[model samples]
Target chain A: MKYPQGVKRNQVNTPRADKEINYGQRGMTLEKDLDKTNQFYLDTKRAIIHKKPTPVQIVNVDYPSRKKAKITEAYFKVPSTSDYNGLYKGRYIDFEAKETRNKTRFPFINIHAHQVEHMRACHNQGGIVFIIVKFTVHDEVYLYPFEHFVKHWDAYLGNGRKSITYADIKAESILLPIKYNPRYDYLAAVDEFYFE
Target chain B: MKYPQGVKRNQVNTPRADKEINYGQRGMTLEKDLDKTNQFYLDTKRAIIHKKPTPVQIVNVDYPSRKKAKITEAYFKVPSTSDYNGLYKGRYIDFEAKETRNKTRFPFINIHAHQVEHMRACHNQGGIVFIIVKFTVHDEVYLYPFEHFVKHWDAYLGNGRKSITYADIKAESILLPIKYNPRYDYLAAVDEFYFE
Candidate 1:
């Protein structure tokens, strides 16, 4: 089987191949890094965060051959909340991970009102919600509190800045040690925030 | 301005109308229904729930026009959990909705192992995790609790019954009310389950 360019396929059990992913918008994808990170947490049993299933809204299928069926008509389903969620030491963990090349700032338009609403709901339920932001320019990663993200979400309405600056991120977000396994190391941040 | 057959021009403000949408195998796509349900909930303020954004592993994009871009080379990010989640009356709600035409029993293969783990974490954190099974043949929807799903899920490892029958659903699952706003009054079920 031929894999696409920039996609590194592991031989079943590769060690942190995803963690070492190049995020220069050419070598690897954001989801890969997040997946490796989740795997690290799961393996260590330190936290239980996960990316939810893809909602495939199947409209039609074509069976070109007897053994295989072709999904001729399928629309991506609209989900009901953030991309990643789970539990860590009995606290609900919910969040979204985003990557950008614009080193100056992280855009708020990447987030939607419904996502903000979902975060608030998780908060009401006593769950922790936040975002893992990666600045490929500086090769940096930060976890912005859900509260901060929500507070600044409505800023676009007031002619405020469109993105969260590195300084703002440093002030409002927790910097995670990018590891080979679970590339983002988000649980460490979680430990520092709610558990500690 | 030729649009792909699977894609639809949204009179309701869908951002990706120009993008190709493959609605595979069925006229009613689950994504659209889920979106409508979320919109209804948002408009009515019954329970704030929203689906997470699609985790696109964008490998390549073709700029057909300044206003339009077609994703040519992309692969699924191998998501780690389910599609829907939010809050209802101060409780975290996480679930995956699925459909089956099988008249006798629903198939378990439709679910993934990662989702099971994610549910376990949520359940451990006092979050309500479950599945929405829509028997398209009977036009009946069943909301099965995470415990029940998990129980049956584990059973698959020990001949625990591969699929839960519709009759079993009637006994174990909660029957949600159909309302004008969200259509599925799932919060009522939550109130009945968590409170009582």
Candidate 2:
């Protein structure tokens, strides 16, 4: 299985590999699926959502021509907010997506403190905030609202529980439909939960 | 005058140099001022605006330790949307900021076609979209709404006008206040125009 260039397959667990190992699914990663879904949403004029690009700090650039500038040296910078955000039904929609191979729990370590603070701030500003957790082992996806996630986050800080159990997530979150074309139809869940 | 590393001061007009030349203002660039304004907005719990980090395509990364990962090679990528966006008073706010050395007009060439398309899409989704145009030579900043900007943009395409005249901008747009703490206080315009 050939991976994309610059993708460190050994350092991070590749979603393609995880899909094949756990669910015998071939092709299409969670990230790729979500991108496709967002594109589809845009094309259909249903909603406007985008994944923010990975931040980079540039150290050097070479101007080979008047019109062309090429970066010679750079480094990736940690993102301060969620991966996805946009407008839906005149409301701000912001979310972070993550997948875990573990069947029983979604680990707290998967999310950064700044991301949590960002989510809280967005929510306070009357934006709709949520997290999409994919349990690759179970081949399931859950949309967990920021309001509920914050409670668990605060509880963890108080009690030292490092994860949210699958049971708790299933009880608290709305199940998102996985389908062709749009791939991950998470916005359907958004429509149902947020709009309704 | 030394410019920041990786920034080609010769290729494009630097805002700092423009400030020094035009207004004898020595310390702040439009970018820094907007960043401070966004931070002030966040701290005051007034809005949840953020400047999206510059995108980068990472090529190589080195993990010196189990927890430390360093990117060895990368290149900057063009962004698909506006720079700053978030929720303000339950409304989705999206915008791009640019500064020009020209005294009489704001060049249409300064903005990319993709950014115009992005602003149009956000506007279609009922989001409040605008551009912060700073005529550095005149030391004036205007908050130009996307609705009006699109008309001029379309007219440019139709009649080959390459710029929006300073007089037109002053007449059609809201002049944003330049202050000490928040710097470019554009959100005050948003509150007045969008909310009021």
Candidate 3:
């Protein structure tokens, strides 16, 4: 598959070579699914959640006209918080979502240190915080509450395994079933995990 | 009075000609003051608020090396939500801040319609929503509740005044007194307005 100009390989990971993957699921990334789900929720008047924009450090901007401002130089910044956060049912909701092709375990490398710190802070303050993990090879998704995710994170800090196995995630997290309008209904999992 | 290269006049409003303005209050913009205040709140474990990064639409990037991915083309997107949001005392807190030099009234031209809509959604979901207005000429700040601000905004939509008068704001909103560490103790005002 040809990528658009200036697009990097790792940035747009389209697993076209995986013939085992269903044809219907070719381009549905976790972020795109969540965006659709959030929009669905917004339209249904169920929740008001948003994925934060990619953080960038702007350096120089050029204005060719009075109404137009073009950014000429900028750099991406390491995000210091979760990618998704917003209000839900009179409570604060915060979470990070990741999709891993690895069949065995979800590694901790891509998840930043400050984001976990942020989750911990939010959790301590009584906000509903969690991590959503998707295994592309297995075609499975799980929503792990912050309370459980942090235990493994703490263990990892104390010289435990650097990643949590797929089995452990399956056992600890709520299995989010795929749906029509919302695609992956993670908030249903949230309701089952927290409110129920 | 000299601005950095490419900085627009209205973008960087530094009223050096205001002879009545104190010399000590030269460069303290509302955004800078709030950053300091949020940092202070974080350190004290009082709250976990953060300013959303300025949203930019990145069009082209040039990878100079393996480590450096330089953004070559981008543009600022008009923000659809509030600038600041977080969890405070188990409540979802959301707000926008604006500074104006107008002495008599705060105009609605600077505040966008979508931001007010976002605030309304948050307020409907029971989140603590507000707007912080700083009268640069009067050297005073006020935190106006979403319920109150929306009344004037809706009236404006109904062909009323395009702005809210200084007398109305001073009477209806909480006057946020400046302090040393937190600078603008708006949460104290929040507690007084909501919790009390």
Candidate 4:
């Protein structure tokens, strides 16, 4: 498994060392890592964030029993908002996380237009809105604040580049810390960049 | 259909007179009215609140083509958080909406324990948290602030009353005004009770 650069394996806490090794062996995905990180936050009472459920439009359902109502037909719906949102330290936090296998750039097509508009609205209303992009090929994750993200998005709307280059993201975004307990310590980046 | 007491039909504005008449004829539900209210808020750029999609646990899905992924088997999930949440005037707003046919009281069975805990967490974090209770028989809707709701919840936890009395709710909660454009003007109550 790929590890973030400059972090020695021995630096991890001894109690969670075995789990870290197991996580690496399993090849962690961005979604799985965020789930672990959010769970850790909840356990420690640090945040109340949660991943919103997958949006689905149910067409038919079957009631086999009093307690068992099974969805027989459904289709995924385009999400109108970010995947994760909650209150963090008295501030509203909202963000979308996406992973790309493309090594050179993060494409704009990964996010929906409605979601971008929603984030913009939230940001204007003083929410801490951001995007977490994971370049799987490089085993790196970066948090791009809404202010920076919208600049690129508006540029794209004006017939600019279709994607944000890897170099651009590396320079503009906050590189998240990887840890044993939380897996992806993105909130640490939040604390430094936003709350600070 | 039942209308809230002491309001003449002529009191509603003429611009939406036909629509309001149709809404009454069709039987307006709390969920439908809130959808209209939230949509109105969004259209006017007043707020970005949304009712979360119903949570479902998918057991099996089939891909018919590259474009269509059909969910074949799924089940409803007990929600762990409130139904609605968003940013309002820079503060996080979160609430659960419930409807009861009983005219005398609002029962605790309508809400799950996990949702209560989530609301408590948000409230403690300085978020504007509340509960919207619609008494169908009385055609009345009330917004109970988290602070007031928790008192009864704690009492129930201590083997006290299992439900909040309607008269107590009337005395403690804000009665939401039903209107033509927004349907239920709950945020007006928010503006008065919290922001004022």
Candidate 5:
């Protein structure tokens, strides 16, 4: 396996293709490493954060043994939402983690409608809600609150911009410090956003 | 498709296949419908509720097209905590939804230590915590508060019973009414549990 640079072996998929293949976007490198960091966080119990399961609409399974079954006829399930969430500190934390290698901007299409809605609801209910976006080229990560994202999302229909330029992200979002333990010390930022 | 006479279609996979099911262990069904119902509520502006996505550790994928890919290799990623969670009536709701077919009891094995710990943390934070389980044959659904379930869960680990008996569920749980719009009126039960 082509171990993606700086990823531990135990991570579910820490390897990249032998050669660079297009992911239709840039900077999957950031996505990989951050996931690795999150996995590390989960392993040590430094924090209890996890990416949601891949949605699969199981159609059939072939049980070779009574206890073992191979899902052979299952189809990909279309998710109605984003991919990551969990709890940190004493609050119910919900957010989606995405990365864009594009040095200029992060596409709004990367964020789904249901995800924004979920974030909005959680935010309205006073839960900690935000998104962690990694800009691979800049080697930077920002914790963008769902409030701003949703504001732009609701305005997307009337406005023409479909994404936030790197400049805008830097201006409106909290640039979280990358840490060794939690990797995404996001809750700290939330505290900053909450208390200070 | 057959509307599983024994178990509702939305509540598929009601625990083990070999045994008769109970009515008080229908958490799986309750979780799925609540997710949809929560979305319906969000869309209709009633309340914002959500069932968190399943936690997964994706290992491999088969990209069919530039825009589409199928997961070729993956595993049932270990989840670190509860499954269904959302905000309801300005309260944070966190829970693990599970169903058991065991005729006499709901197995403790159906839940993980992390989930129990998660519920504990949420409850300590003043977030409303509980679990939904359905007993199929009895066609009854019960909402077990986290406070109660955790006690039973730990007792089971300390050489007590392997599962919670039906009588215990009936006594300590709230029986949720079946509603056509949401299927399971868990919020109503939460109202009684938290407010009344």
Candidate 6:
């Protein structure tokens, strides 16, 4: 059955050419991969992470039938917090997923000011907060803690570099493993870095 | 300054007549009241609850300038889970808020099937789940635990009553107090009922 836009579906097909070129490789977008991983986590009763719905300013809606309400006019709003958050081992887990084509540095522009502030707020409230940085060219992912991001964020404003070098990320953050089913097992990195 | 459509602003003004008549009364919509309460919670370092932004499907966007990308066409999407979720004392808090015109009963139709399933999933993961019900006619609010809601929900599916009576709600749920700043201080009820 054809589903409406924004409905969650498991079997998302990537472009055929891309699929053929990247066979046996996790070539999907970071968000899609994370969604799969979160779904796997939920299904296995391990965690319950979810991407927050894209904020929208709705002005008009059309109801053609009792069962259907189609939004006719709306605008996307900037998110105030991270993209993903949920419960993990009875603790709140919040993080934003960002991908960079640059293999040497993760650009600071990939993140927003409000998101950093939100991470600080969550951390102050004793929640586990981090950022998932994906080096697309290198095909590597890292779970970088919010503290490290904040350090670089402040330094950039005070005569430091505009980006965090891959060397710094390697030194400070935990590397995530890419699996077939759960795709990006970042929570494993969380378990090692935060819990252990 | 003109703000974006969905940005939360504190100084929302209702009409003059409504303001005058409902003066000294919490006459704002359940959503507005909850937003105020959540803001209060955030400010006082009590909790970090946030209403999930309404989901939207973007069909088109126009970039008038390099920095300003305006969404030209989009549609709202139905939410799959509760309206509000956050952290309280290092525990996950998830809930939905609903208002009813009926003074006697709260119709189960106000909630969707997916929301019920979502609540169950959250509960299974050891998250604190509940529903905030507002009887607009009676000007009463209650924090009804998910367990209680589930009991009635299942009963309604199996030849039971179509709605939960106000008498039953009064006996089973914690009544929320309306205040000036926070508006609906439901967390106080949560503390007394769940943590106490």
Candidate with top lDDT is: 3
On residues A37-140, what C-alpha lDDT tens digit does candidate 1 reach at each position? 88787777676666765555545545665544444444555565777876667566788888777868888776776667777767766778888888876787
Per-model fnat list: 0.16, 0.76, 0.87, 0.87, 0.27, 0.65
Tell me the lDDT of model 3 at A123.
Answer: 99
TM-score-based ranking, best first? 3, 4, 2, 6, 5, 1
lDDT values of the candidates? 0.70, 0.85, 0.90, 0.88, 0.70, 0.84
Query: Compared with the real two-chain complex, what DockQ does model 1 have?
Result: 0.12
| Residue lDDT tens for model 2, A1-196 | 6867556775466677664664735222778888999999999988889999887777787777665566666666778999999998889999999888778999998798899999999998789999998988778888999989999999998999999999999999998877888887888888888888
Cα lDDT for residue A124, model 2?
86
Q: Model 5, range B1-196, lDDT digits (tens) per residue? A: 6674755653566444533343333534656676676766777665555565544444566666665566554445557768776666655677777777666798888777777887776677677889888777777778899888888888877977888898889899999888887777777788898889
Per-residue lDDT over A1-196 for candidate 6, one digit per residue giving the tens place of the 0 to 100 score: 8667533453355465765566325435788999899999988989988999987777777777765566665666788889999999888899999988787999998688888888888988889999999887788899999888889988887985789999999899988888898998888888987899
Per-residue alpha-carbon lDDT of candidate 4 for residues A67-170, written as tens digits (9 for 90 to 100):
68999999999999999999899999999998877889899987888899999999988999999998876778899888888998999989867898899889
- Candidate 3: clashing pairs of residues: none
Q: What is the lDDT of residue B12 in candidate 5?
A: 62
Ranking of predictions according to DockQ? 4, 3, 2, 6, 5, 1
If scored against the real structure, what TM-score would every candidate get?
0.67, 0.86, 0.89, 0.86, 0.76, 0.83
Best by DockQ: 4
Superposed model 3: Cα runs more than 4 Å off: A1-28, B1-28
lDDT of 5 by residue, A88-191 (tens): 55556677888876889888876767667767767877777888898866768898988777777777868877987889889889997766655667667877
lDDT of 2 by residue, B128-174 (tens): 99999988767788899998889999999899999998998898899
Clashing pairs in 2: none
Candidate 2: where is the Cα deviation over 4 Å?
A: A1-28, A65-67, B1-28, B64-67
Once fitted onto the true fold, the runs of candidate 6 whose alpha carbons sit more than 4 angstroms away are A1-28, A62-68, B1-28, B63-67
User: What is the CAPRI rating of model 4's predicted complex?
Assistant: medium
lDDT digits (tens) for residues B1-196 of candidate 1: 6556534655335654432232223315555666677777766666656665545454555565554444444444545667777656656678888888777798887887887787787787677788887776565667889888777778887985678777877788887654565667666776777778
Give the Å shift of residue A140 in candidate 2. 0.9
